[model samples]
Target: MTGVLAGALGLVVGLVIGTLGGGGGVLAVPALVYALGQDARTATTGSIVIVGIISAAGVLARLRGRTIDWRTGVGFGVVGVPTAWAGSLVNRAVPQPVLLLSFAALTLLIAVLMLVRGSSSARRTDGAGPSPGTPDGGSGVPAAGGGTSGATAVLEAPTRRRATVRRVAKIAGAGSVVGFLTGFLGVGGGFLVVPALTMLMGLSMPAAIGTSLLVLTFNSISSMGARIGHLDLDWAVIGPFAAVAVLGALGGKLVADRMSGAALNRAFAGLLVAVGLFVGVQSLLAL
Candidate 1:
């Protein structure tokens, strides 16, 4: 009975992870603990295995689409390794209830981020910005004489240097935060990774999703590896659950091509809010 329940739930979770990435896998923790009768700590460990394997399928589904940006994805993932380990250490010091409340709060935060991202996307599309034909840096005109003067090049060099530094900082900061959450909560961090890749790293939505899956795969490994000896996962349960989810994820990735990302984001945000509210209420009552 438990196996049947777990396999059923894992399929749904994998579909979400394959279709949406990021925060989608966060649902696994709650499902594992509340629906499947796993302990909170064990659930986190299992989430890594499930989400990671499913994300691998998502990555493969995206392979021929040219949706991935390898350099940015790998760089972001590399920065997260140590932080995820640190987050796992922190996780052990916290009580189960408090950890759960923290997870609920994180869910709420992700929902808010989704709405804000949607709004921001709309604004970017309609805002008073440069026309598509505008010159470099959105300047009103092309460079002098259709080329830059040596003096102009010298002047712009420092500006470009500053821009590069800022870009690095943005990437590093986003990766660190996502990495910590990955380790601390055993989630793949796809919710945070998609937006960060799109907004911070200038990837398109499809590209971001693909790249985000790769980064999430790294995060899952980091999180699960940190818990290697600390947690004992039930292979009988995890095996069937992960295998089913892998198939579901592949199917979801196929269907994702026909779906609207905005619609998906809105629907996901609503679900997160509902789940967060329920968890918040339950935790408070228990306390």
Candidate 2:
């Protein structure tokens, strides 16, 4: 009964990850371990399945709205896929306490980024470049230099060679980090994805959110592959959890569209900070 209850709790975890990004999977591991009393390895495997399903649902929702930026998403996806698998392998090797501690700290860090608002951390441009999305940041727009209005346009051509290289490098670097985290932690990489897109790629909030979903999808698949040989592939666990997660993800997408962006960001940041504190305490306690 307790195990079933814990599995039910997994639905809530999936919903949060689907909606917010930072704390969902991070908390899911603990929920599976402590709430359900599963071994860390089993819990980690469970988290991967849950995160993947929720992320795919979110991507589907985003795609329906025509919000996904395929080019940027694919670019990030290419780098993240293999790394996510590697991360899953790492998760198998690491001690549970260490994983929890690292996850907690990451959650807190993302929360801070959420509060800062992507624009504040963005590389300064004197508002000269074309905006990446809607004039108000709601409408998905074309790549700045793509000379088209469609959201699918390739990323804007960098004005300076140095800047272009730097931007590409940043995207690749962020993708790698996000991939590893996803595989290792069973997260969808939303905490890092949104800020990285907004701050580094100059994408608007809507675009970033949409793009992150795609990146998450690719990362999940890659990581799942890593678990294939070592773990039990439990369809029994995946079925109910995925159904609830998909429903919750759909609801979250609606909420995301309705909420005030600034307020949401602030709330998310605070949440991250709280999660981080929890992780730090868990790590210390482990010692």
lDDT of each: 0.80, 0.71
Q: Write the residue-wise lDDT of candidate 2 on 1-287 in tens digits.
A: 55467457766766665566434566667766666666667877777777777778788777667667787788888898888888988888898778777778788766666565545644344454545754655546545587674434334443366686877798799889889888887766777777777667877666677787788778878887888888764556556666776777777677677765555566557666766786578668768
Given candidate 1, what's the lDDT at residue 186?
74
Q: Best candidate per TM-score, number? A: 1
Question: What TM-score goes with each of the models?
Answer: 0.90, 0.78
Clashes of each: 3, 2
lDDT of 2: 0.71
lDDT of 1 by residue, 1-287 (tens): 87887788878887877776655566788888888788778888888888888887888888787878888888888999889888888887878898789888988887888789888888888876666777453765445787756777788889999999987898789999999988887777887788687667877666777888899888888887788779779877888888888888877776666777777667667767887887778778878
Clashing pairs in 1: 22-190, 22-191, 23-191
Which stretches of model 2 miss by more than 4 angstroms?
2-8, 117-163, 233-238
Q: Which pairs clash in model 2? A: 108-272, 111-269
RMSD of each: 2.7, 7.0
Per-residue lDDT value at 207 in model 1: 73
* Poorest stretch of ten by lDDT in candidate 1: 134-143
lDDT score at residue 81, model 2, on the 0-100 scale:
86
